[model samples]
Target: DQEGRIVFSNPASHRIWDGVGIEELGQYRGWRAETGEPIAPDQWPAVRAVRHGETTLNQLVRIQGSDGSEKTLLNSALPIRRADGEILGAIVLNQDVTEREASDAALRQSQEDLQHSRQLDAVGQLAGGIAHDFNNLLTGVLSYCDLLLQELGPGDPLRSDIEQIRHAGKRAAMLTRQLLAFSRRQILQPKVLSLNSVVEGLEPMLRRLLGTGVSLAVELDPALAPVMADPGQLEQVMVNLVVNARDAMPQGGQVTISTANRELDIAQAGGIPAGAYAVLTVRDTGVGMPPSTRARVFEPFFTTKEPGKGTGLGLSSVYGIVEQSGGRITVESAPGEGATFTIYLRRHAGPEGAQAKKEQRKVLPLGTETILLVEDETAVRNSARRLLERHGYTVLEARHGMDALRLLEESGRNVDLVLTDVVMPEMDGRELVQRLRAERPEHKVIYMSGYTEQAITSGGVLPPRTAFLEKPFTVDQLMRLVREVLDE
Candidate 1:
């Protein structure tokens, strides 16, 4: 067939190449350059197959059609031989590998996306850990700074310095809080909140932040359900997503945000638990992400933006919030094709299981009650003892939980409140609470810890109504919390 003549062609060849199907099967058997102008018969695979008495394969050479469009062929030819070993024409085969090539490319892209996602997850964990510890330190510093301001006179220079310290500390605390949110380690005060409402409330701010050049649109499903999560943290999630969308569109593009009610069944593929959820999606028409960048988008501190433009923790924080709230997230993007991020958070069934609203009561004086305070830090314990003694209460000091227990056993005095650290060398707050409860069941106890409630106790080990005061407590917070617990 290679003597400038065609041999055999599959029926699908016409369907694939549009027309040049069976008509030219045996008639058009010639080797042509991919240019399709014409090739000498000796240079053709089919011609070589017959002349050299050997098979030949055309891996992926493009062939021109009647319309000048290129068609790729995986062509193979074997010499057709007679019974006495005399060579005849060639039996050629052609397969269209266009769709197969496309599928393979898509599969490669998907694998790359998966790998990037995993890397981001690892980075988020690291960032969250750092934020968690930094938050604890900030909590102590900020609380004490506020307390210091109360002791300084209005005209004192020390008061101004303390105020500046408090302001700076507060800013640092906010950064740490963002980190904690990304890590899912912050003390959460979850509530039943509608995502639609949160978005609506943030619409004005988002529009302003996005500026006049970029357009913003919102699509809200009326049937969208509520999710159980800290309202502040949820708001933070929305803000971060909006900010990310804005950054993506520096050249000016549309940012669209939408929410809907979604249900993930057991067979769903997104690693989401089977449940009803509120789906939040943010899409940007800015510079779309390439396969390489999309993979690490959610990794903490992993950003493709020029330095000083990003911390790379925006998506990571979003990931942490959704995950911690029993939700999942998925991203879709292609190079120059824009991006869309979808977050699925478990829907709250109305407001039935919401944590009780914290009711603020009037601060009262800690009458003549004796308080036993156990702390390891010299400065903190001394400060606490002085603050309590000044508040008209008798104070007993112990360096550790064990020392406190010894004081309780030896001193026959009636101890009204047992304030102890949740983490200590001799005995933690949890063990001390158990011991005190066992010895004197009626005693009041206030536990303090910088970690989350889960981090402080293993499982559900702590008893109900056991008051907690997070550390670096101000004189008023400590006295007020103690008084409230004692009064109860």
Candidate 2:
């Protein structure tokens, strides 16, 4: 068997092995393709074919070249025998299939990514539906609670109980908001803002949230440009990131919040458009995530924290907010190496602007205007009617848009304002308004809903100067909005 060595190799075989000839290849090492264990000389395909007079077919093997490069090959060997039943040598064939294996692996990874995305989207849709229905129920409870509070005396014993109920309802409302945020269904009021200012404003609260164990550092860019985003959503994003970092380092660590200006090319921006962006980075010196955990970190309801400790929607909501704001988010981490989350927001071509000042609280004005209230939900419709009637307005209730139109046509009364739910059966609020506008262009209208469709909103916001009222509004909110619309 020629001293248990390869005696000859064809030009193709030599070329496949990086120009190493048969004699030179004899010194190369081989390994099991699956487990990477070294193969002994006797265990090699050629050795078994020649020395043991055995035939082998299509065995996967990995060979290491002299330059430390590896190639996966499918090999076959057959014993060559002479006339006297003597074994001459062996013929071996190998095909380099490194590229094929790599391509298959990449395809599998792409499929997995697609499946994961679909799963997240399904969960988001479910969450949005649930939140929408919950908001309707909450509107009744909150409206009733506000009415009771308004009727109670300052010294009434039942006032405390009603206040507690109101507090719990508010908390539930907050949870619904979080769910809507994760589903990218929540309404956003985006404004041009300086990222550095937002970070600075939240510093005091962040420090308090981190407690005594964790330290906070801010490195803001002095010349950072303004970004168009919902200020409240951005704050929520920061709070979630900081809280996540703090939890990662239970024993405490330093959290650094920074901002910078970046101009990304197509390749660097991933699916987002290539443009100038304002970058917000949150880095922590806490235990980080492995590849497996990192892959699913943004999936809705996926959490590493124990039950009752985390909602698991923080990162998911963050992802939705950034995406809805026309931006992208990325994370860099490895096991025990800490983590860095970067948010890239498209730069707004405008000067930094101050946040809108909070309106001074004034006593809600009562109106005697004839208002038509249209809603599909009976409880919500009745509660709104009572609310408006208690404030001295003559309210006409309708089960839906068609009923409202019929009521308008039958009654010769000139309705001062039409307060209608945006989503309804038979006729949506938009269609009803369109019809009403045709008949009476000067009629005032205010659309209300837990969630509005794109047809009603431009870029997730109500049309400019259009009146709108979100569901679960308090008595004051309802009264003020009604009065404001009527005045306009």
| The best candidate in terms of lDDT | 2
Best by TM-score: 2
Q: How far does residue 133 in candidate 1 sit from its true spot (Å)?
A: 4.9
Per-residue C-alpha lDDT of model 1 across residues 190-275, encoded as one tens digit per residue:
66788887788789999998998889999999887788776777788888988888888888999899999876665243465677
- Residue-level lDDT of model 2, residues 141-245, one tens digit each, is 998898888899999999999999989988888777777777777667788899998998899999999999999999999999999998999999999999999
C-alpha positional error of residue 443 in candidate 2 after TM-score superposition, expressed in Å: 5.1
lDDT values, one for every candidate = 0.70, 0.83
Judged by lDDT against the true structure, how good is candidate 2? Answer: 0.83
Clashing residue pairs in candidate 1 are 5-28, 5-29, 6-27, 6-28, 6-29, 116-295, 120-299
Worst 10 residues of 1 by lDDT: 453-462
Residue 171's C-alpha lDDT in candidate 1? 65
- For candidate 2, the TM-score is 0.76
Model 1 lDDT at residue 20: 39
**Listing every candidate in turn, what is its Cα RMSD in Å to the true structure after a full C-alpha superposition?**
7.4, 5.2
| Per-prediction TM-score | 0.69, 0.76
